[model samples]
Target: MHHTTPPNTQLPFAQACENNQAPILAVLQTALQSSRHVLEIGSGTGQHSVYFAPRLPQLTWQTSDLTDNHPGIQAWHAAQTAPNLRAPLEFDLATSAWPTPADQPGFDAVFTSNTCHIVAWPLVQRMFELVGTHLPASGVFAIYGPFNYGGRFTSDSNQAFDAWLRQRDARSGLRDFEAVVALAKLHGMQLQRDEAMPANNRTLVFRKSLSQ
Candidate 1:
């Protein structure tokens, strides 16, 4: 059945996405060599999934987000002809139980881009907890967004963006890199790679620790 479009306007399709997709894929190509099922959280305009799914045909891309965002995601999904791209699912990481059924083996990898800063800190922590629960011990979780390192903004633009975000919503702002890493550790995840992306953003890759 056809889905209605979401209310949010089309994002600018950031040049950063264009510039970084290849590099990000290069890393994923190696990191996800054995991974087949990938769950993408908070797929805003669905550009990354559309771009990556066709390139990695062996990997099934399952995109998800809050129900309100499903329509836009469907619109983007409709444009993709890749057989590996699945329909967008309704998911909210803050919730205790995932919307997906338990029978489904957890995702081989969980990916998200440009979302952490938009949500609150507790939600971010909860997201890691959910990721830890849904992913296998050796599975990967990758997040891409602007972030502050050592409690300082990495760039002036990011600082301005942080201010803008806070002005819009007091709790919305760029997160601290160290804090995220520490939280991930608490959930039995280890920081694997922290790559600097174009436009002052970063891609942080974490692996769920097998030791529990």
Candidate 2:
């Protein structure tokens, strides 16, 4: 997908999003090929939505974030005119209500990035709970962020990052991969891939059981 820069005035921009969007799309190109609709959690600047929606034309992208991030997301959404992409919705994992429709099947895929380590641990758990509750059977859930494996930091950089996170908020820090997997399992999803992304981040793909 060719991503154009938003005019300097309106929306916010995250270099990290610009840096990582290509790699994330490389994976989602295949992972989300069959998906018709996707719910993006924590769409920081809506850069990913505009960048991805045009490329993956088959899927309708639904953007969501807390109320505070709406203007930037909306601005980005307005700047781009991908019919497949929806406007930003005010949805927070911990506070806002889930936008589930009783008559329709849930999202075909759920995507979130750089959120787990930022929110409190309980919110992460709650996020998974919402994923399990709203994702359709066999639906994909992709989460991208730095994560520890076997309760050990993957790199010294990640170690320092963790320390910085704790210093900022004692309740927030990188999550252990194993613990996260176990939590996903309890919620009826199974890990399908733990992709090593650029920098120290990972994009974990989990799929719900079709029988569930």
Candidate 3:
């Protein structure tokens, strides 16, 4: 049998999480200024959610991912003491029933980091679509990851990374920023900012435009 599964560590750690969290939080501070409720998709390892929730006391941070990731996420949630940080919700954007937030108007922000390239393209489309449905007017969506522009790689390193990802899983690789923005537009979201992040990554912020 082939070893297809990633190693299981109780407190599963990710160096990328530690390195990028501070920078990402800084951007979130400004992006989510008026926001209250935030739904974080692909809350892998529960690291980013736990790290960010306490700092942003004004917003309630919700963490969610596939069922297999729940135990590790719960471990992190248990360790954290912030009241605003919520327990992980077992969710799949493409397959889930499209659950709405408990509050009336819906979530004010949705955040996902380093997820698009790993999932299949159809699911990536679904993520953009479903985020549109969950967000209230003026809601913010912040996606952090490396992406190609004009269908060209930003750096040779990103090119290499993309190749490695595809070798690991044929469907996995960097997505074009233009294509992603087009998808966001179709769902009533408008690009508000595109800030460069460390390690050649970017944090793209979009705000919901439809009012109804």
Candidate 4:
């Protein structure tokens, strides 16, 4: 059977996305079995949502980021047709009110990639608090990015990357893994899995507990 491929859509591409998507997918396939609605924070190029939505048709993927990122997200969403993929929306973690309705029961899972180090420390705290407020009890929250452990950089390359990030913005450097776990704990989530990824990055999964 002859098949015609769709023209490639030129949405902004993150090089790391190309390298890490497959491994991330492998982890997600296992972690997301019980999730029906996933809200992806900082959907950057929207590649992850587009890639995963089709593979896991059982889950509805909601992509969001700062308002500026919506265009690229829309472009990628438009290029593909998936019933489970919703249109991108504005979701600033630091804000008090999200664009989505307040009465909503919140997502079954929340996912973010390569965003923590790029945002300020306070925003990271806010992100976790918002996840606690917006996710149901026992819902999962997953973060994928480079992180420090025990006050040390994981690799020489991550050290250099940290230096580069600090040069751009003094606050824009990797965060400590333990600190993140502590933050999650304060907000009623427990660290579930910490999977090491290619190029010194890690995916941390946290599950909201019933106590909170």
Candidate 5:
């Protein structure tokens, strides 16, 4: 999830994905205990979908990302296919029209890692907007990445990372946790957990309001 590789890699890989998948899975096993289906946004190289689907055998894992990332994802899927893991869907938060509730009503949980800091802010808002619209009452949404708190970085490493990200794209940098929670609130979601992750990262979990 740190970088997007070219499609022609035949078998794209990300060490960060490998290092973090286990810890992420441990958190997910509990967070998504009752979830029967999950929609994975930004499936980068598809490493997470493959790793998570087989382990969380109770749920069907739906992978999605921009079309350019599909070949790498498909290649990974071909190498380690899971019956519960569906193929990747072409999804772009900035441009793709999200599936209607009738078309994707069964997705009870959503997951995305290392995406918020890379995409522009408006797209990030779109992601929460679509998730808020599509997710049913009590649906679970989990996002993993470095986030700022109270308008400040959590650690020097995160500060440096944010600098690096901004250097690459002026619009892309770590987001404020408060702003994220506020956005989620607008979408009828409430924060359920804020877990500390390795390498100065965090995993935030939100639950859609039942009143929705």
Candidate 6:
């Protein structure tokens, strides 16, 4: 999910992971406090997975991404000693079926960071569909990334970041917070909270309706 892919590196690294891990964890400690298992979409370099799993010892962290990113994820996983950390799963919301680990009934929570703005809009919707349908009732869904509020950028930096993302991939850009909330609602998720993150990013937390 981290955009900057280091070149010619034995173990891929994303500087943003180091910068935001603590803040993200602060939020997760409470948001996912009751979660038993978490499915991480777009694990990227797996830096976040490694850093977070050991800290959140209560839940099993499952890292996933497209197959090409597996090597980097494996590299990071290899260096970690967290028994709760699972290996990378080959996940592509656009193609691959939703993963259901044989060891568990299904994941109770879902977490993804810096991914919605990187993929096309349809894929983003597909991700929501999968999560909405597969996640158990009263599950958690937390996504971290830059988001526009009421069709307006939250800050000048986020505005510039949106422009850069579109320039890089016309199909990819900051998603509207309202639109995302609406989408989640359609999938039986209710907004729980929105936390401000560094660099104009936001972490949106939603809880699946108990009746879902």
RMSD of each: 4.3, 3.5, 3.3, 5.1, 2.6, 1.9
TM-score on alpha carbons, each prediction: 0.88, 0.92, 0.92, 0.92, 0.93, 0.95
| Candidate 3, position 123, lDDT | 89
lDDT of 6 by residue, 80-128 (tens): 7699999988899789999988886589999999999999999999999
Q: Report lDDT per candidate.
A: 0.81, 0.87, 0.87, 0.86, 0.90, 0.91
User: Taking the candidates one at a time, how many backbone clashes does each contain?
Assistant: 0, 0, 0, 0, 0, 0
* Model 1 alpha-carbon miss at residue 17, Å: 3.5
Question: Which portions of model 5 show Cα errors greater than 4 Å?
Answer: 1-9, 100-105
Highest TM-score: give the candidate number.
Answer: 6
- Residue 198, model 2: Cα distance from true site in angstroms: 0.7
The window of 10 residues in a row where model 2 has the poorest summed lDDT is: 1-10
Best prediction by lDDT: 6
Worst 10 residues of 6 by lDDT: 1-10
Candidate 5 residue pairs in clash (backbone atoms < 3 Å): none
For model 4, how big is the CA root-mean-square deviation?
5.1
Off by over 4 Å in 3: 1-9, 101-105
**Root mean square deviation (Cα) for candidate 2:** 3.5
Tens-place lDDT per residue, model 4, 46-88, is 8888898998887889888888878878888888768888877
lDDT (tens digit, per residue) of candidate 1 on 158-197: 9999999999989889999999999999898999999877
Better of 4 and 6 by TM-score: 6
| Number of colliding residue pairs in model 4 | 0
How do the residues 175-209 of candidate 2 rate in per-residue lDDT, one tens digit apiece?
99999999999999999988899889999999998
Residue pairs clashing, model 6: none
